[model samples]
Target chain A: MGKVVILGDKAINDGVSAHEEQVSNLDALHGLVNEDLKAVNRVILERMESPVALISQLAGHIIASGGKRLRPMLTLSTAKMCGYTGRRHIDLAACVEFIHTATLLHDDVVDESDLRRGNATANAVWGNKPSVLVGDFLFSRAFQLSVADGSLQVLDILANTSATLAEGEVMQLVTSNDTETSEDAYLEVITAKTAALFASACRLGGLVAERPSQEQDALASFGLNLGIAYQLVDDALDYSAAEKDLGKSIGDDFRDGKITLPVLLAFRRGSLQEREFWKRTMENGEQNENDFSLALNLITKHNSLDDSFDRARHYGSVAKDALGLFKDGPEKHALQDVVNFCINRAH
Target chain B: MGKVVILGDKAINDGVSAHEEQVSNLDALHGLVNEDLKAVNRVILERMESPVALISQLAGHIIASGGKRLRPMLTLSTAKMCGYTGRRHIDLAACVEFIHTATLLHDDVVDESDLRRGNATANAVWGNKPSVLVGDFLFSRAFQLSVADGSLQVLDILANTSATLAEGEVMQLVTSNDTETSEDAYLEVITAKTAALFASACRLGGLVAERPSQEQDALASFGLNLGIAYQLVDDALDYSAAEKDLGKSIGDDFRDGKITLPVLLAFRRGSLQEREFWKRTMENGEQNENDFSLALNLITKHNSLDDSFDRARHYGSVAKDALGLFKDGPEKHALQDVVNFCINRAH
Candidate 1:
């Protein structure tokens, strides 16, 4: 009931506010935290090194791919918003990226994926063995960097998050291609896998700034909801015909037999024949080229993609609401825009 | 020269010392720290758990598969021998094993291994995906456990060791099946991959006891050499006809194309035809049914197995000498015998 109460007017309002329209991308966050982001990049480059040539080569490839550095930016901006001056945030922010990179490398291996961010995956280029071991190397490097920061609290936050991330990935695997997967189970998986790291990154920002516990918790809440919003939009985009019109590729999750939100919603809302179709395509993982088109058509017919966007908006509003704890400032507004930026990708 | 000097008389003195016979196994070390070892086992069981059912099941399978608990025992014995009277050793010992277990899981995936300790590997039982994620989970748990113990020093030791271990694995991968893998390169891999963890485990044991830096260094030195001895003998046993007669499965390393000391030595000492054979079977990974017998013959003819044992004994002697800093006592004696146990497996 407590969490349910927050899903109210913010989720229902469809009108885009002026500020929300203006804040349609991560540019504001980047502008606010640009210098700190550069410092974080420096630390990341410096730490990914090893005597083993392939370790650095494969790690360097994936890391250099065009990621927005959104997660670490959250850490940097949150610390700045708290009005605390410290350099530890740079080191910790790099650590956040390192953890994310490691997860991506291993994820590619687990998914057997060939492309990431429009480039070849490490596993695809270097093979799974090197990718697995290099992921391990980067993972160990993240912990080493954190230990050097000399904060047990920081270590505790990250270590616990890392475990949660792994548990979430395993749960996703267990639930993959199973048509009967509940909304609650999918939420659990995304929250653990995606939101947990986001939460920890923002929490570390506050922690490094020596902010009060209440402020730290507020930032964590903001990050958690934002992450859920971010992933929901990502999943929805895979099925949105508008996204396809914009020349973006679609239907990776569908092809991989991933039982995501739109699929879950469509299956729950579809006819008996549609349910059988889903069972064949997703559960049994039998797909021809036309299956994705048909699947997207059924999803659009059911308004599943639209409903998924609505859900993303709800989490986005909640993410901005958590920013209410801080005073009026550019930092708060930029962070709010980050939430809007995440959701606007769907609109 | 300093290190080479310790490789003197102690290594060459193969006479059966009176105490060496009594210390034929790990019984002495186990008797000294039986209670601590039990507590460590409890911690290991407690920490491997997750809401994800497969994580605990897979972890339990590998952990309960009759490992001698040797790594943790090194931590436990080193702590006790250093006059530590705290309970932190149990938690830290468990952390050591978690790190080891995590490495084993990833190694199996990297190696495409099907068996470990005569039981199916977790990767073999659950597939590579769960095994990979679970390894990540356990690794994170190890860091969390260390953070809870509230010792940055212990965190530093374990974190550095973890990075070294990963680097070692990558280096091994880079050299795998390259019959040109230098003896120096092979040593570097095992030292980084195996000995580094042992060194850190023992160093942490001394650190927990609040011992002086010199004592901690000495303990690390002892563990480092012991780890090298352990792996060397393990590699030798894979080709030893005597060990094959003991009903132990052999030729796994051979089948895997691992470039260990015996293989490297045999390849170096072999004639032109023998070199051709190794390049075909190892570098080309083209082994027939009878190729293993031919390989073993070449190894024996070159005295590779005996030379590997000599290297193991040399490291064992250095390991024993590092204990000279400690007074003669049962804890010290037990640690010494643990070294002997590792070396005696070949004898």
Candidate 2:
């Protein structure tokens, strides 16, 4: 189930020694966690193998393409932090990943995206129809996974999160071409799209651990703040990232008419000429090379990227403070590392 | 909740009288059903109202296009037939309809269809992006509706049905061009795409009624057979119907490269000239005016349309037999009429 043997900072720095370090890090968590996590992984693999050949092929293509498994890690890490010894944590972990994956598949289709992680999107290769249907397949599979666990609270949290995720997506779609899109609206969209899953991950962990109500709240807050920070940094990177390292084109958001945080901030602070350019380009729902660079320039000149980074740091601080609710342990340290990783990851 | 009205056969023949009768029929279904159905309707309306202006506008437009409400009808009718006498059936009905509508929206997008039930498809009018997202919204809403019932069996049935439905869509996408699509595969597609939902409709009814497990299976069988029969008839109508009645062009499936039963049968039985024409035209996935006439000529020559209809009648008989497991009533008669109407309806 742990098909993701991620080669991140430690893997790059420590090479062969990193494997042992990874195993030791996992071992420091609950002993039962390994078995449950394996179950979750098995279920995801088994379910993703669709009888429909094309769907299975495309999903396998993407899942096999290395992702950090960050959402699942959050689920498992939060559960461990809350002293969860149960196996259902694995199901929750899978649920989190399924929701994230479904969004990615559909988002690619919606965006008409060609590249992701330096590879072809499902829609790019298989066509939008299969991608949409497979996204549906994964969504149903996720719910089935949750139902198998037979916990009402877990279902409620996951279900609500799913609704919130869709709402966020719809909101993003609406605001994509609106130059006047505000920070509040951007925050709402990000919170719904990204943070809801993160919050649900930790809250579901709390449920599995049978933690006190207050501790559950704390865990949820931790996840929400961490998710917000993660998204802000990711948004900021769209302008700053080199295609070779980031696996995406710079100013891709502007080219797509996506009014992300930096663009929204720039719109609020930039010159009249800059404002007119954004209004003309975004309001017309048209993009060209010139429009892309001009939009990027405004954001950079207004220091909106810096503002977004500061916000991400603020959220990272809040995420760290959330750890105070749990007992001191390696789980908390792992959670901290995850927060750091979220803000620092290049792709 | 019953926004649609069902006219009595007598009233349907009587023009103005039919209109009044239809209105009354809608009112009756709305009033007689428990509040559960109302709750489902409420959830559906609320959920479909996308924050994205374009999406919300299009969804409202499509839903307001006046569908027959057949899926929801089956759900409500089955629940009533089972003597459900509970509040949950409305939500289940709404859940099933939402799934159906979402699939319809996505199906239109995949098919690149312009007209559905004589109105412009959401995708055709608004664009694929909104259609796809709104479809997703409806799907999520359906899942939420199902979750509200808090029944594991309901969740399992709907979730599995969803996967089957999506698989059917994918299969349709893949096999539409392959002339070798067999009758068995065609049945498989309908069973997954159409019958599964219908069967679930009956099963939910049984569940709501608190009927014995044996009776539940019987109702499911009835619904599944009827649903398959309905689809066969619907497909047959594409060739057999007049444009004004079918609200689509004649030979629509052939034009769309959908290897339906009549065409498959005709390809099996036609003369070598006809076979060669089909092989070069339809099987080759190339259609033209001549191909249209050639397909019609073959259908007339081979009587495969009749053969397909005979198959539908066979399933309709099977559906009635399953209904014999229950006692007689107007509701029972209505259920029987549904099977008959499915086969006999013009569209």
Candidate 3:
């Protein structure tokens, strides 16, 4: 079982050193499932085919982009860890990736984001119309794939996760630019939008392996906590990571008036004048060149970044404990390594 | 059993009166399946609910709008025609409506449509972001409904239909603003986008009845041809129907550079100067106030509207023949009347 560690002012040094890993990438997890990962990539390429040229062109662009293929790999690795082998995981893994990709296409359009993975987003390259429609195409394609797999349970998980994904996105949309958004509400948004899919992906791997119900629940818990940690780090990175490592422009959240954790913390802890600055820039949408720097400075002075990292580290510990019942092996170790990689990115 | 009726220039008058109906609405179809229709409506109202008020707000606005629950009616009526007495049709019918409503939400965003059913569209009222996400939410909701229905066959149908719907929309995007688009290409777009769902909706009715594959095929064929005729009439109505009857602004297709059959025919049959006019207005998207009237005049000059209606009448006959194998009953008779009602809209 994992304990909640409330960090104090002096706990940042202890937390960072305790959670440090020599490697800051998913290479170990990928290596463990290297063969299965290749097979999953092949399935993605094969299934993304369409008679419509733009669909294939645009779908290929995003699928081939350097997205780390993290979600599908989770399914592949978790299925392997369960010690049951079948070919269904390959197709199901591809289906999971398809759902994720579909969400991305729509997400970029909703966010009006210009860059993803250091490349032009599909919405930016093609336009919102094609991105939206193609996203829809990919989403339906995933359902078709799952139907062919012929598992009512799989269909249930994917369908429920998809609705939650959209709900989360809508929740985020409603909360955006409202600096008064509560931490609970912000957590709800990320849990629904980001963590839901991650949890579903890992659970599906266990499902395909015909694992026991309790193990399925454990895998889901692992994924849910790990996903929360992953998104917390991602949100933190948007404000704190180097431009080259972030793969996107820094302060995009600031410019978009997004009410992320760091922003929420800074606003809650800011002086009267600083709170007005947040209200004008985030709520009223009045931002200038100096606003992002000031926002960043405020977040730093308030130790909001380190605090966010500490919170992610806590969730990471819970994710690891969710897998405590599984015996120590390559698959289990590799999965735990993924948790560290996600959290360590903030460094 | 249907013989294709290739109408000549002189065949317009003969086609119009033959397909005319005493009523111009779906009153008879509604009457036959009126009870099941009510049940389907209950399911829709109960299911579209969400904690997020805007999803319910936008979904309710469109669901309760006056657009004649035609697709779900197709499901209910067809299921009754097959003598299906189960409760599955209620939910599956609602599921079909959800898919259709989701498509409409996304379609408005893609077309940048301002008015639907003569009211401000969801996108128009709430902006594109919420509309897109809510559309995704409804799409997933439809899948969840089908999953609850617990039929892999039904899931396959809805999934395939969804992919085709999106593919058709993307094809339309590629073909839009091109005066050189062929009549075949235009038909391909509408058939995939509109007719695919209509086919699936009717097919699901037979499926829930546990009908034979042949009967399912017949229902699908009946729905497909009827759907094509429905869209053809819709396209013609866009050009020739009175503004009040059309429910949307006349010439929306023209303004959006949508290459429907009438526009394609008028463009191909026009003079070199007329071709350049289309280039400037439809392709280049340069239009003045008088241009719509000019375009209407050209369509009338070439009898494009009547010919388009004639084509719709032909498909209506094929749709009738698809239902010929079944014995005559209220469901059968009402279904046939729907074909006439669809074609006679141009009158």
Candidate 4:
């Protein structure tokens, strides 16, 4: 027991109180894993510090912005579920979160987003250049962290995931305005951009644990599915989530010309008029809230939202099935809970 | 013996006739570094190829817009100079070029200019989103290339340089609208953003060659000095360069409210009216090409251009002096040529 985890259940619950049952589930696991959680928190804080003053400031802003810190939690929980007894897991966990934060910062800048996590985005507050550069800084730091354990395998996992993430971002950037974006294309983009990193997080935990090869594969698969589920839910919430809950305007993605799965499905299923509405708003970047609501109406009429939810549920089930490959443990159960939480969450 | 030394008296003159110089350097280096250079080229092209058609199209657009691949050439030259026989130097060389290109793409977007390398910039053809995302993609690919070497030292060198580059960009972004940028601060920013990577390129070459520690230090120092001289000359050219020769618009930096070394010196030495003039134009981004002549007048009267030239010469001399640590050879002489070329170029 070289590392300790001091779970911040109270803090997380305070932020996510509306889902009291979900919070309770997380809290119970936090209590059980509390002894080992502190190491993760320490790794994150220490690794986020940089010689660059601007990076230090913006990295602090993002880290202290009070999101769920879910990716790191997944890494930690996966390692514990695998019955790991190593300190490297903390580094791996922090590395995952750093990768996530780096992407978030860059994404906000790319989206020219003003709000996230119920606060002004780093770009909105500090400016886009700092957000982009500090994102690069965090990414470099994450690479350093990934190599800390001298695991070439971990490096390979992260390096591939990082490249995939960038590729997905480029793909999304390209297709953001193209009316031809299909459901499959949207899935491919999100899986690469979002799910790939999440999958890497889980895979890295298994690697740190030195779990059996079979279990490691299962964990990675579980992570991949959960990531897909999580992103689908996010896409769904884009249409339904309030500005307060989502931290950005409703249809913000559409406004930014991002064609997510729900919209893609709706476009495919909609009549000529509905398709025209999407093209006019998203492709031309001409939509206001009124057009956005009309588009939502078309999505509902076509049951496109339902189709996206079905896919999310499918991925969620697959994610849980991945945990069945692991032996019964609090960590495994927590992983399962995460999968459920991803698909079911409103925001 | 494994890597070719591609050098000739006419190689630099090949810029006026791309065909003549292309044959000299690429073929000569290819013959000598055929084995390693091929691997390097492979890494670059392979990583650059995308399953998504649009990204690959955009990447091809920027990559095909030729510039003198000076930084990679240094890597190849130094690796051979230090007697490295391994193939890894090739990949490392290409990685340096990738990083350089990525920065150029992003800089163009942030600066919002149209021309580069005597042709269209990525942003000009594809828009800012593609340019930004592709820049990120190239960066990610460069890191992947670095990781392939499995050297933590190489990773650290590249990672630290990447961070420095980002920090430099942020610093520049912050001071872009300010007229009070000191020459020292200008140097500091360029050293981090531009020189650091050049130094890292040479250092990576030394690492590849596994040269003695002192020689490695000398190579890195040489690169830093040469890179600083290179950028200082570049900044000076913003005022003195012919529009056709410079590719980018003359005084484009001033138009973007960037306070480079000469401009900073000019502002400091100018009278109160001149200071007010600078504040309205360079600080407020109110200047036009009509103001270029006046700005040039201020620069010349204050001898700011001369001062900038002197600073460049100092860096060039330091760079040439650092070559004393290398063994006497044609490669060393060629390296010296780079320093002279950087400091003495008209454009």
Q: Which has the higher lDDT value, candidate number 1 or candidate number 2?
A: 1
Per-residue CA lDDT of model 4 for B262-345, tens digit only, reads: 889989888999999999997777766578788888888898877887899999999889889778876777777677666655
Summed over model 3, clashes come to 0
lDDT of 2 by residue, B1-347 (tens): 11112233322311112235334333344444435555665766776775657656776787777566667777788788878777787778878888888899889888889888667888888778777777877788788877878988888888888888988888888878666788999899888889999999888888888889999999899999999998898788767734324233566688878888888888888777777777777667766657787687788688888888899999999999999989988667777777776665542
Q: What are the lDDT scores of the predictions, listed in order?
A: 0.86, 0.76, 0.85, 0.77
lDDT tens per residue, model 3, B158-277: 999999999999999999999999988888998999999989998988998898999999999999999999999888777864432424357888999988988888988999999899
Off by more than 4 A, model 1: A1-24, B1-24
For each candidate in turn, the TM-score is 0.93, 0.90, 0.93, 0.90
* lDDT for residue B314 in candidate 4, whole number 0-100: 97
**What share of the reference contacts is kept in model 4?**
0.59
Model 3 chain B: worst 10 consecutive residues (lDDT sum)? B1-10
Pairs that collide, model 3: none
Error of 4 at B65 (Å): 1.1
Task: Supply candidate 2's per-residue lDDT for A23.
Answer: 43
Mark the regions of model 3 whose C-alpha exceeds 4 Å error after superposition: A1-25, A241-248, B1-25, B241-248
